[model samples]
Target: MIIGIVKEIKSSEYRVAATPGAVTELVRNGHEVIVEHDAGTGSGFTDEMYEAAGAIVADEAERVWTSVDMIYKVKEIFPEEFKYLREGLIIFTYIHSNAHLDQTKALMESKCISIAYEDISDDKGQWPLLSPMSELAGKGGFLAALHFSQTINGGTGKLLANVCGVETPVITIIGCGNAGLGACELAAAFGNRVNVLDINHDAMMDAKKRLPQNVTFMFSNRENLVECMKTSDVIINCVLWPKTRKDHLIYREDLKLMKKGAMIIDVACDEGGAIETCRSTTHTDPIYFVDGVMHYCVDNIPSAFAQTASATLSNATLPFALAIANKGVKQALKDDKHLRRGLTTFDGKLTLLETAKKLNLPYTSADEIVSTF
Candidate 1:
C-alpha cells in the first residue's frame, strides 16, 4: 500500500507522522511511503534520511493526499485540508473527534476508514498508543504550570519549589491516571508540596502508598476539590472520559475562589478537559488568564519536542499500522480483539457507542462493523 506522511500545520506542531526508522520498516514490509517535504525537519529527521530509507518526498500535501492509500498523522485534520480528503482513503491518527465536532462531521462526510489511536486498547484494557503521549503531557504539565505560576505571567507568584524555611508550593493534581500520576511524579521530584486527588478510593490509597515524599493523596469530592483549588498554587487538570466529552470538574465560577495568579494547566485539553476554563492553546501563545487564574491548554503538548515524541509515538503505532496494512482493518480486527476496540469511526459510521450517544448521532456496533469489514 502507498502510505503518506504529511507535515503538521497546526501551531507549533512539529511532530511528524513518520520517521526514517519507521520508513525503513515500512519499506522492508513492501510498502511505499510518501512524505510531505520537510515533514521531519522539525523532528530533526531530514528528507535525505527518509530517502535513504526508501521513502519519496512530495512537495505538497495535495500530492501526498491524492497518491497515498493510507495517511498516518499525529494530529487531526484542519479545515483547509478538509478539501483534500477523498471518499475511500484510510486515515490512521488521533482523530480526537469527541473534542472536535467539525472534524467529526468532515470525516463522516468524507466516508473514509478512520481510526483513532487514543481509542485503541490493549488486552489489559489500557490505551497503549495514548500512554506515551500521556506520559509526555503529564511531565510537561508541571513545567508549563510552573511558568504560568509566576506573577509576570499572570500567575499566583509562587515558586514550585521553595528554599529552606520558605513555604513550599501547594500543588494539586486533579486525577490519578497516567496524566495525573505523571504530573504528581514530576511535581514531587521538584520538591513541591503536592496533593493528588481521584474519585477512586483504591486509586487514592494506592497513590498514597507509592507517591513520593512530597506528594499526598486525597479523595476527590466537591468539597475537597473546591478547598484544594482555593489553596493550591498550581493545578494540573489531567482527567479524561476517553471518546466522550469530558465532564467538567471545575466551572468558570470556581476560578473566583483560586488565589490570584494561580496556574491551571489542563493536560487533557485535547480530550475535552476536566476544567471549564480550559481551551486549546498553542505552544507559541500557550497561557491565558481567566479571572486572575492562569490556564495552559495546548492540545498537542508532545509536539514541543518532536523528535522524542515521534520516536516514542511511532513505536506504539508501527505494529498496529502494519497489522492493519498486512491483514486489512477487517481481518486485523478479527484476529486481534484489542485492535477491534480501537474502531471509532468506520466508513462513515460512528461505531463507538459513547461517541454516538454524546453527539446524538447514528451508530453501529463495533463488533458488527468489524464483521462487515
Candidate 2:
C-alpha cells in the first residue's frame, strides 16, 4: 500500500504527520511512502532524510495526494483540499468531523474512508493518538501563559513563577487528564501554587500522588471554580467538552469574576464548548482581551513545538497507520474494534454517531458497515 505524507498547511502549523524515522518504519514494513517536498521541513527533517528512509519525494502535494492509497496527515482537511477527496480514498488523520460540518459533508459526499485519530481509543479507554499531542498542548499552554503574563506582552506584568520576598503566583488547572497533568507538572515545577480541580476523585488522588506539595486538588464545583477564577493568576483549562453540549463551563459573564489582568489558557480550545468566550486563534494572533481578562486559545498549541510534537505523535500513530496499510482498511477495521471506533465515514455513509447527531446527518454504525463487508 502507498502512504502519503503531506505538509500541514494550517496557519502556523509546522508539525508534519510523519518524520524520517516514521517513513523508515513504513518502508521497513514493505509499504511505499510518498512524501511531499519539504513536508517534514518544519519538523526539522529534510527531503534527503526522507529519501534516505526510502520514501519517494514528490515535488507537489497534488502528486502525493493523488498517487497514494491513504493520506496520512496531522490536521483536518481544509476547503482547498476538499477538491481532492474522492471515492475509496482513505484519510487517516485528526478529522474533527463534529467541529467541521463542511469537512464531514465533503468526506461523506466523496465516499472516502475517514478515520479520526482523536476518536481512536485503546483498551484502557484512553485516546492513544490524541494523548501525546494533548500533553504537549498542556505544557505549551502554560508556557504561553508565562510569556503573555509579562508586562512587555501586554499582560498583567506579574511573573508566573514564585519570587523571593514576594507572594507566589497561583495557577489553576481544570481536569486531571493528560493535558491537565502536563500543565500542572510545569506550573508546579516553577514553584507557583497550583490548584487542580476535577470531579473524578480517583483521578485527583492519582494526580496528588504525582504532584508536589504546592499543588492542591479540589472538586470541580461552581464554588471552587469561582474561587479559582478570583485568585488564580493563570487558569489553564484541559477539559474536552462534548460536541453536543450547548452549555459552557465558564460563561462569558463569569469573566468578570476573574482578577484584573488574569489570563486563561484553554488547551481544549473547543469553540463555544468549554469556555463561552473561546474562539480558536492562531499562533500569529493567539491572545485577546475579553472583559479585561486575557485569553490564549490557540487551537494548535503543540504546533509551536513542532519537532517534539511530530516525533511523539508519529510514534503513537505509526502502529495504527501500518495496521491499515498492511491489512487494508476493511480488514483492519474488522479486526480491531478500537480502530473501528475511529471510523467517521465509510463508503459515503456517516459511521461516527457523535458526528451524525451533532450535524443532524444520517448515522451508520461501524459494526453495521464492517459486517456488510
CA lDDT scores, all candidates in order: 0.83, 0.94
How well is each residue in 58-131 modelled by candidate 2, as lDDT tens digits?
99999999999999999999999999999999999999999899999999999999999999999999999999
Top-scoring candidate (TM-score): 2
**99-144 in candidate 1: lDDT tens per residue?**
6778888888888878888889987767999999888898888888
Q: Each model's TM-score, in the order given?
A: 0.94, 0.99
In candidate 2, where is summed lDDT lowest over 10 consecutive residues?
Answer: 153-162
Predicted structure 1: lDDT: 0.83
Question: Which candidate leads the pack in lDDT?
Answer: 2
Give the Å shift of residue 361 in candidate 1: 1.7
Off by over 4 Å in 1: 205-210, 242-247, 270-273
